[model samples]
Target: MSLTDSEILLLEQLIHDREVDKLFSRLTTITEETNPNYKLLFEAINSQKWGFNDKNRPVV
Candidate 1:
């Protein structure tokens, strides 16, 4: 299958968002308190409803 230019851009943005989510997760893990920034990032990561395969059945 082929992706259009807009689809490709969306895919790129999703990948970048996932990377940022990973970074936030790691930072949150290392930090002691669940500060506002960490809470916001955690919520943003959890709020994402896409990026998972059939077997995963959860946020990616």
Candidate 2:
């Protein structure tokens, strides 16, 4: 599925929001960043729910 320009901007806005900082930080951390959970991370990130065009709310 392809995303339009607006959708890309929307997700970038959501990801940059302060509320999502913790998860972003964790993903950048040493241990977590090197974990084998890369598959899950890749899946979630590639999914429409967390990618550039995702419209769903993130599970808190």
The true-versus-predicted C-alpha distance at residue 49 of model 2, in Å, is 43
Candidate 1 stretches with Cα past 4 Å from truth are: 31-60
Best by lDDT: 1
lDDT per residue for candidate 2 within 1-60, as digits (tens), equals 999999999988987896678878666564644767775685566665432436665653
TM-score of every prediction relative to native: 0.48, 0.31
What's each prediction's clash count? 0, 0
Report the poorest 10 consecutive residues by lDDT, candidate 2: 48-57
lDDT of 1 by residue, 1-60 (tens): 999999999999999999999987777673556587767887898788776677876554
Where is model 2 more than 4 Å wrong at Cα? 18-60
Give the TM-score (vs. native) of candidate 2.
0.31
The TM-score between candidate 1 and the true structure equals 0.48
